[model samples]
Target: MTIGSLLLGSTAALIAVSDARAVTTVAEPDPTEYAKICDVYGSGYVYISGTETCLRIGGYLSYYVGLGDVGLFYHARTSDVRTGEDQGTWQNNTRFTLKAWTGQETELGTLKTYTETRVNFGNRHTSVSDSSRSYAFNGDSILTFAWIQLGGLRVGKDWSAFDMFIGGAGDVLNQTPVPYGALDTNVVQYYFDAGNGFSAVVSLEEGSGVVGTIDNYAPQIVGGLKYTHGWGAITGVAGYDSNYESVAAKVRVDINVTNELLLFGMFGYGSNGKLNDDPMNAIDAHGRGFYKIWGGNWAFWAGAAYELNETTSLNLQLSGDQLKNYGVAANVAYALLPDFTVTAELDYDRYGGSAVGKVKASEVNWTNANKKSSVGGILRFERSF
Candidate 1:
């Protein structure tokens, strides 16, 4: 073969091979469609793709530690009492919460949904039934809030309206928890806005916990009325517990005396009807139900919060019940940074009634008949979005 012909053929063969080895290119997708801001509900919401529904996501993290005297947060575990083991007097906790929100407008009204899930890693409390186990959860993980609302009507799991309408007892870290009236329940509720400064709520609830939950199909009933103004507000709530055929009522007043100072007082009373004296604990001897959480037939709660400055605040709460149960709590909150906060609190409790345990009042650690009083303190650090 001729040199020129051989060179041309080789070059042609190389070109064909190069083309055959070339990588195939797949088709590219179209440009992404940006999400549209949805302002009808609130900030941080964006319209869902291909739909008008608004969606948002948020959460928080918290680290809390506490220590206290006997009968309060710190207690003598069954193991400690039986053996000479080290007393676990401190509680260390870490918690994570996830939340979601959605909103859509409809002919009926504004349709909205909210959900929250909480998980915690901590140590469980053991006054009589258990031994302290390290790194164990104090309580089961929970769906803290899950509810749907269409205008005035709402249904799902949430805090009872009796507490929501009456507001809680200031900002103090009340370790005992009942003074705030922050009880949880599944509810069917309706809200009414009567124009200027007046509103009302009607709720049918299924209570939580063993002693509070209904023993039958009959549901609990609650109603509330509230009036709001520039100088604070006045609110009242009443609940009928079907299980025990008992009734509870609360009245609250809030006075915003100054821009930086806020004060509130609440009084609760109940008819402990249909007493079941079978339980070892006498808490229900007078028929304590879900709505009547305090130790006795009547209880009073008062509290105040003062803004120390732009980044600091102080809070306090005092409460007492007809059964001679008393408690005091105080706290100071400081905003360490934008979305981070640090809070420290002190708590005191005295149980002068037979509501603490199955033991005699003189032998019960919660009773003044033996220990006089119990005290505790906690520190918390939180970050939220």
Candidate 2:
């Protein structure tokens, strides 16, 4: 036999021997170490099997009280209702997650399958509904992630590998993500690690908008590259749509100024020029950047965003000509003790230019059609288990 055939035969023999040994070495149960059972299958399971399996569970909870202004206005260009007020109340956020992995050895190689689910409790009942508590129920907050990995190939429902930056710390805080109308979508992505802190990814995701052209739920392809080091990380992406020949570019950068401070920013542009199919001939540009300072138990952040120019006339008709949205925020916390702590935050938002489009000066509520140029504060008390 050739050398290659000999090697394969020897490997198969070794595996057969190993499996036989494992079966013969199965030990008897020990009464001394008998523990309560958590068996999902079979008669009982005192302990988990050592078959290359893994599990992890983690998440957090948050309760907040906010006092702010919710105002209203008119649609007429001549009307003004900028200064209005509304009521305030308390809100709660509770989330939990569970994840597990199963491992199996196949002819090709070792493979792993994993799935995770997240539950956002209070998300089911929000006071923002126009009617009763039933009306308040919105959003399918339950998120699921599943994937299989064999060698370099991985498929799953997870964060688009093309994402530039994560909003907030992936937490439930008033302004953890600095939301000023941002986009975050799920996708099926493939990633190739280039070693060192650089990597590249390509993904196929559900087109977020502009339906009927691509059969509604058609796939959009996106690709991006990212690099990271001890001090910072940067990412960039380009996306394409087959229907209208559109392309979008997005970029984000995060810098660690010190052990306690962070600086970050993001920018994106979308256009339909590449395909020679400029149906709406649309273009969009938006940018946001912030600097955060941290102390022993206190932190402060200040940032601003500007939408330079928009080709979408609908946006212009609603908000105004020069759309500038900016905000400044700060937070302070005291450990109080190991398991308990108290925190507070303050923020202010300012909207100018054509940014007044959908906002009704007379409606003092916080919605897509209302603009807020006011200040607000939040307080929270937390306990750990």
TM-score of 2: 0.55
Tens-digit lDDT track for model 1 on 12-68? 999988877675655565345446789998898988888878999899999888776
Q: How many clashing pairs in candidate 2?
A: 21
User: Over the stretch 1-385, how does candidate 2's per-residue lDDT look in tens digits?
Assistant: 8999999999999999999999899688776444534333223233334333333323334454555521111000111224322223333334455665555556766466667665543322223434223111223555566777765566665544434322332111344312322133445666677899998877766533333124456666777788989998887766665454555555667677765455565554544233323323321112111111010111222332222222100000011112333445555555566555566766555543221122332442334543448666656666543
Clashes of each: 0, 21
Best by TM-score: 1
CA lDDT of every candidate = 0.78, 0.45
Off by over 4 Å in 2: 1-50, 69-86, 99-116, 121-141, 162-172, 175-186, 207-218, 241-244, 272-322, 333-343, 352-371, 380-385
TM accuracy, model 1: 0.83
Off by over 4 Å in 1: 1-35, 70-88, 127-139, 175-182, 277-283, 355-371
